[model samples]
Target: MIRSASQGMREGRPLSSSQAPLNVVGEEAQSRPGSGQPAGTTQLLLLVSLAHLISHVYILALPPLFPFLRDRLQVGFVELGLALTVFNVVSAVAQAPIGFLVDRIGARRVLAAGLGLGGLALLSIGLVGTYPWLLFGAALTGLANAAFHPADYALLSAGIPKTQLGRAFSLHTFAGYLGTAIAPAVLIGLALLGGPGLALGVVGLAGVLLVGLILPMRVPAAQDGADARRRPAGSPTAAGGSIVTPAIVSLTVFFTLLSFSTGAIQNFSVAALVGGYGITLAQANAVLTAFLMLSAFGVLVGGFLADRTRRHGDVAAVAFALTALLTLLVAVADLGPVVLMAVMGAAGFLSGVIAPSRDMMVQAAAPPGGSGRVFGIVSTGFNIGGALGPLLFGWILDHEAPRWVFGAAVGFMVLTVVVALRDRWLAQRNSGAGTRGG
Candidate 1:
């Protein structure tokens, strides 16, 4: 049976033990973004996950669909890259505004509308023969993805039990990752048998169905809008009248850097494998799928530790360090597909673990009434990294062999590890001090 939150933690929000292996705070993490979720927290997590799944599959539509789209549009590298740049740019820029809307209007309204429109946009992509029209569809899809995170996370923090936050978030991220991961194989297969239009239509129809399902789900947004209205001034103190803070800028930086590394890999990994080692697209896609699966596992484990460990920052540091080392190994070593897959999977697992910890830390560090703002800011940074990752990798790919791109990715991983270590130390010291003062 699932356990109740430990002492000092509130209902629906369990925190890691103060002295647990990577403990930062026992219950403090859960309480940071105050939750008054109705009794149906599990159901709430499912709804949140489902909402994300619909939008994420749409965002990830590019990967497997790329081969088909390239053939149909007869696009060159320059054109393909430009379309991607626009898509990522629009999405990155939209995160902050979308989060602001979430803060103002509540997540349910924003997310529902975004998902429905995004679903339509996905269908439109299948029909749009013009490059500009395709780009327009991509922008709409990005907008839908942007709408999901802020409100979804706020709802999760409010509704899900703290101890399960990691698992919940793992499931949350996996929703997107899963859709993205499965997309290549499924879409490719569909294309082989049915053609791009049919494949795209099926994918779009799936999103529409999900949106229809969620429309009737009736998610209550108690933690976000209602709370903001009730405490218009916001919570000024912790339980004992101490200041409540949420980590904002620093978490954003970490998330952005991490995303940069991942995005670089996403954009260039196929080319690198095919050009550098002469691997087939199917093989390359397999490697990516393995990597994503490991990442999902990493997230689940990381979330579990987030609620169990006392020193979360250090744990994050360790996770990033592992990712860096794996990246370096992947870059310089002339390993076969098996070894390469193993290392890549392990790297994804370790690095991916940072998701829940990062989210939890940022929410906890926010000053009163700023959760939406901070979440938005961090999300924008993440999308920015996503936007830049491809462009940067593409530049390197244009100038140098695939090895150079791998080296650049290694550099990103190293930088992220250093930043994560710094974050860990700061979170521990500040949280520890907070405990003593309280």
Candidate 2:
């Protein structure tokens, strides 16, 4: 039973009724039997991470097939582009609603269904080979894409031990990064073996096979549909608190700023280097590739730091601040090829270091049983930033101002730092308030 504030104070338990429920739930969550057996926890992480990887693979998979698609479908670039635009738009709009569904039904079932749906969409597109079918498949895949972050985070939070969550989160992110890095090569290789259809079919089949592997295995009790329904009324598990809290809203903004800053560099750095510095295309690409590879390695290192520290905001803020300085240096300084690669790679490393800390902050803000919707809401920021980033930076390039690409990225990073610090301050205040007696 949740005591009133006055009663709690008299009993020397100072938590408000609202706060007490979460504390109780947290204890229950941590103490649940079989929650952290190493083998089971590792299996859960592997499946979830692989699902995330496939989700990212699908995101970039189609672009490599564009040439084949254009030839086979006899479509113009505009139509093909519209398919991608539709994908992003649908994914962004559906994420929040899908998240709500995740909290209601259970992440495990939703995740399997999402993966199966996405695979079928890809396979159908490959088999059909028509423009309208392509559009439909793109939209369907977008909806499936919406489910990944919410479901993955929900499962990880409920299934993994609290002590090891940072590393799990980092590994999950690294898998997504790996997928993006490998997608073009893998898809193109498959295309070479047969055709575009073969490439899509193969990748799609992988998702379907993964679904089979996940369906029979047990998920955390907290994420089981029957278990959620059985929870006592008035508990945090039964009545999930508000999803649109100040902390969530702020985190959403922070995600958007973070996404925009990173997207600018990822989408435009090579072009910026080539045009602004009069560098060769090969050199520019080499620098960008180094940046990307180093970033992936940095994510692993950041996981250890995330596990060791409670000051996630400070870590994120410091990393973003350093990245901003590097961006500024790229914009204004003239450097040799070796020096450029080192600086840009260092910047990417810092950016990757922010990933685990970013997830930690989001987890900190989520109430028990609310991971799905909170992560869903915040992850929408990526789509928003992705949707807007091209227009902003492409315009800068079109206007013949490549240096501004780095400059704009730097500006967004600074904004990210401010938001990170603000979130940290808010968390500190809330923590202090919760500890004080009424």
Candidate 3:
């Protein structure tokens, strides 16, 4: 009976304590004063969002600096690309281990250290006299970058009230996108004013300062010693044990597919529009800008929907289905430029609307105490998709098959709907089983 209950809970059913079922570890972690409730919630959310912003800024800082590095250091484009590749590869490899550290020593310390490390590494890039040193610095930055998602999501999951989690996730994601949007302008402006080296040094110092600021703030741990002390002697921690599970693995794949679809559009949509749609570069850029801006706003709207509905899968399914339809229409239809822009904007809005609900699905699937590790493992999907999507879409563009780009994205969107529905079905089945047992 106990084994069956544990299995059921893992499948998404809620089990009573008497059932001796698997509990989401650390579900009660936020009950402590100044952790998840009213007094500390606002402060915690702000700090986490700031961290999210900073992480994205750092991720983008190097890219804008690429031209500068090539001109000043006389490095080839391949060498510069290698530097970015090293950063991403190192980050991808290190994220899971860092998540383990977050779970063990707490997110507060890890987050602070990551900020400091990334900042110092960026500073090193500014001061380095040789190309090898630049590569080394990039590797360090990647190592630092790996800490954000796992730590940020873990802390937010443990510290925010369940009722407000959707908004928190939306804000966090919005902050990241904001950071990405601003990085180019900020870096270029600083470079023009003070030289590239000086700009890099200043930005790096800012990161260090943020570390100092965050060090003093408390973030709730996924599992704390105090909470452990309060539990019955033999009772399991919520979602304790190994972080790897079938459900988590499925979510990981889901994220990878989602990223794959979006990454193509983000990286190549302007080029695709210019090449295939007979649009000027400026016009393409304008449409892309509208898409991104509307998407961000859509995330805010999605937050409200996430809070109002418990059917996260339904929300995701509907949104993605719409996105797929719009994207397919863009591929097949010979619409006017304005109509194309409107269709793309609508697609972006639908895609954005899925953001908060997608996050809620992950939260529901996460084992309480294991959030850090679980998120760490799952988020690698983004890295994988980021690494691969460009190659795939770039091939389509290189072959003059630009229309296929949107079509490919549509295919991925359809796959995402399938995954979302599968997850929803499992959750519903588990809920029904728990009801019957009760």
Candidate 4:
């Protein structure tokens, strides 16, 4: 029973065959129960993945280029380290406001601005020669990096079905990691071909140009935006969104600890191997590659697992425990480079499992139409921890001992476990009341 658009021309007119199936599927998709994704979600995922890849292309390139940056600018360890530290600090703090902007303006504009501006910031880092000017460039880089999540995650929340979020997040994380993993190997060789500084500068130029090209690209329409404007005033995702419920607030604390832990791993792992374990920089970087490669794999697999998982939080908790044990093991164990690399690989694998599940948890908890702001706020934890972890760990390595770095990381893990246990207990209490969503 379908009414064709052309049926008005004549009641006797035969209906086009294509109209029948289109009506059936469209009606079925619209009628399906629950908060589900749109058909456009798959394309959005591709675009998001590409955006992540581009963003991380810069990230992966940065660590290896630190040597070049140091020599070219004639700066010391403190200066170079501070540049990165400040970058993350600025980037982390800005996410909340950026999130707010995305909520009002839309993801299309924010996404375009972040990537496009990020490209400009990077290009300046290359063109600028003075130490003070270079620091300015780093600040700009931070701002550019800070702008991506709110818009990207918001699009994801509205377009994709809640159940499929794990896979989407995993794809996002994996794409970024893949970009990071490729940077050192590819860019380093390119740097060798010309000059390191020249290579980096050229790469940045390409990124800027690419962003300019991409910003003008077309995007699909989002129904969520229209729906939000039509909703009653004082929705949870509006004013009520600001207040995190007790359990949700607790989860935020857990996210903060997780952020801190990731920061320690990302920032210090290379330096620790070099300074504490007596490994050379090249050797340490090689080990870092292992860590990132496995981490990339972990993100992809974690997403897959999360998508299939009936109990995502439990799976996340188990993953967290493994990461904790791995951190502790790294702290206490003394091993050769080969053995250490193997261990890091295992640690990376286990740690990778939590990312997708964690992202899903946040998405699930976010008040409707508030994904942009929530992602923005939560993402700050990652960047802020990025700032703190290194400064804290580097101080220990430079002054006291390398062992302290892992010990501090262990503290973060312990906090994570406590939070996870608390969440489980609350879930159990709620379960008996027949309030558990599952």
Candidate 5:
């Protein structure tokens, strides 16, 4: 259960028998942002979001430097590509196990350790500058990458006020998108100023520095500790039934489809526009950039919408249906440049709108004290989609079938709509059954 106003606490101070119990007013005063809460909820939110931003920065860091790395390290493109494949594969394999670790030990420590490990990996790559060392660094970074989703979601679930969760989640996601958007320029600029070595070194140091903020954070208790204190020994969660229910499996599919659909637009839209429609490269890139920026803005708007309505399924369904139509139009029609940009931007915004509600749906599926395991397992869909989408879309582009990119995206979006609605229905049915049983 979520902490109510009466359950709120002062910064760094847990309730003790020696102290008087807090009144609702007193607890609210301590818990509310900027009201003398220890470490402050607002501060924790920003710190966590900043960590998310840096994680994405590291994810995209090497991609922008591939050309520089090729020349500097004297390696072929295949070798560099292998580094990325290793990174994604290792991360995909490790996320779920690490999630269980988060639940068992705690999220903050795991998150801090990941940051430290990732930082050391990058620092090693910069200092060593060998292809084998690069592969080693990539593998270590992958292990570090596996830790973020599980730890970050667990932290947010435990720390943020229930009422404010939607907005908090949106901001967190927005920071990540912002990181990806900036990484190319950040890497290019750093490489140009000094070298790729300098760029990697600086980024690595940034991660190490951020650890300072995380270590001293006097945040609220994590769900693991709270659950141990609050639950009776014989509770369902204590009995340990499997967390991988049908609902969890369905949500995983939903995430995979969502990632694949969005990855198509993100990775291939510019290429498709140029190849299929005779658009200039500049025009295609402009459209893609607009799409990405508008998507980030839409996440903020969706946060407000998520807070306002409990029907996240309806929101996701309607948004996805419209997105599919727009994608199909893009597939079949050759619109003017301005019109194409506008339509793609709209599609991006709708896609972004689905994000917070998507997280909310996952949150709902997560049993208390099991958020880490649930998110760890479901978020692996991202890696699956990321790995597979590129292969399939790159093949279509290679085969000179550009319009099929949009067509495939439309198919994925339609499937997502069905899954979203079905998940919602199942959740409602379970909730109703539980209420009657009670």
Candidate 6:
């Protein structure tokens, strides 16, 4: 039996039911033990993770295809870069609105539409003969890309048990990273075997198939009416109130700085090592690969830690502080190649360790029933940082300051720690005030 929000509030617990018709039965079943409920939950997790994975694969597919596209279209690097810029810009600009839509309409509908449209757009790119057509296709993909975060997070928050939410988030993030990790190899191998056009068509077909798989699974809708009716008179989401609180805004900035730090390392570390440390390209790339692999492992570790602790902001603060110190060490140290690789790997691990905790903080701070919009608004920080990091770090490289890449990374990490600690303090203060009032 699915309990309404009013019932749950009277009972002093928020039940795991949603406003969407399809989700009520599924969520209720998942909340109880027996009848293979665990297996059902696992299936739900896999489905959500797959959605996350596909979104990232589409996001990354274009980068590998860029080389082939440039050759086929006879375009310069600048024009190719513009195509990427347009994609990210469109995604960033559209994400918050899509998030709002996710709250209003339904996450499942938006997510299914995004996958289908993105796949079709990628197929269009493969078929188009002109540069303008390529740009058009990329823009469509971006608009589609904007749907994933809001929809995915909202669904997970509604469907998954609170105890397992951290792990669910970890798995979702890992799938995204895996998608990005595989995209280069998958796209390039396909292009090599059967031309870029055929490669793109294959990937696009896969996305369309994914949409077919997802459509039958119903998603939960926002619980605004239930929450509004049950909430205290002066609460944030009551009486036509705003969901964008100070904690949320702070979290948004925190995400931006975190992305900025990671973006610097991901985009420039190899070039910086080659230019500044005189490491060979292969050696630098090897170090980078190790960092990435270990970082993924760290996310797994972080998930375990998140479930054991409620102080998510503290977890993020400590991880990022250590990450900053490690990154600074990388900037200043002139160690042997092996030692440098070890240090970089450690830094990567610390950064990854923050991921689950970072997400949990946002989950903690979100106004009740507003996960989609909050995540959507905060995630734009990623696009903002992603857009800005390349420009800033590229400038550093252009000025022949390769060592400054790590310097800049460390700077961003410090800023991230500050914001995270502040968020923690705010959460703590709010909790205390509530305690006293009670």
The deviation in Å at residue 101 for candidate 4 is 0.9
Error of 4 at 375 (Å): 0.7
- Which sections of candidate 3 miss by over 4 Å? 1-36, 221-240
- Candidate 5 has a TM-score of 0.91
lDDT of 4 by residue, 1-438 (tens): 645434622443321211211111113222134523334456667777778777787655556777777788888867877777667877877878888777677676788778777777666766666678667877777787777777777776665555677888899888888877677777778767765666567667766666654454333233124335433456655444553477557666777788777767777878777777877888777777787788888888898888897566787888878877877888888878888788778778877888888887777656655667777877776765666666677688788577667778878977887777777777778887786555
User: Which residue pairs in candidate 6 collide?
Assistant: none
Give the CA lDDT, 0 to 100, for residue 167 in model 4.
82
Superposed on all Cα atoms, model 6 deviates from the true structure by an RMSD in Å of 3.0
Error of 2 at 428 (Å): 2.0
lDDT against the true structure, each candidate: 0.68, 0.84, 0.79, 0.69, 0.83, 0.80
Model 4, residue 146: C-alpha shift (Å): 1.1
User: Ranking under lDDT, best-scoring first?
Assistant: 2, 5, 6, 3, 4, 1
Segments of candidate 5 deviating more than 4 angstroms? 1-39, 223-226, 434-438
Q: Compared with the true structure, what per-residue lDDT tens digits does model 2 show for residues 1-438?
A: 734434643554323112222111223322236532323566788999999999999898788899999999999888998898889899999999888888788888889988999999999999999999999999999999999999999888776666788888899999998998999999999998999999999999999999997776556655665335444466654666567888888889999888788898888888988988978999998999888888888888888889899999999999989989998998888888999999999999999998999998998877666788889999999989888888899999999999999999999999999999988888788889988944
TM-score order of candidates, best first? 6, 5, 2, 3, 4, 1
Every model's TM-score: 0.81, 0.90, 0.88, 0.82, 0.91, 0.92
Residue-pair clashes, model 2 = 0
What is the alpha-carbon lDDT of model 3 when measured against the actual structure? 0.79
What's the CA RMSD for each of the models?
Answer: 7.0, 5.2, 5.8, 7.1, 4.6, 3.0
Candidate closest to the true structure, highest TM-score: 6
| Candidate 3 lDDT tens digits, 1-438 | 225533654565433212321113343322335432434567777888888888888898878877888898898888988887888888889988987877677777788888899989888888874699888998999999999988887777776767788988899888888888888889888988877788788878888998876776655533333323333344434435566777888889889999999887888989998999898999888778777877888888888899899999899999999999999998898877788889889988988999999888887777545567778888888888888888899899999999998899999999999998998898789889999999
True-vs-predicted CA distance for residue 133, candidate 1, Å: 1.8
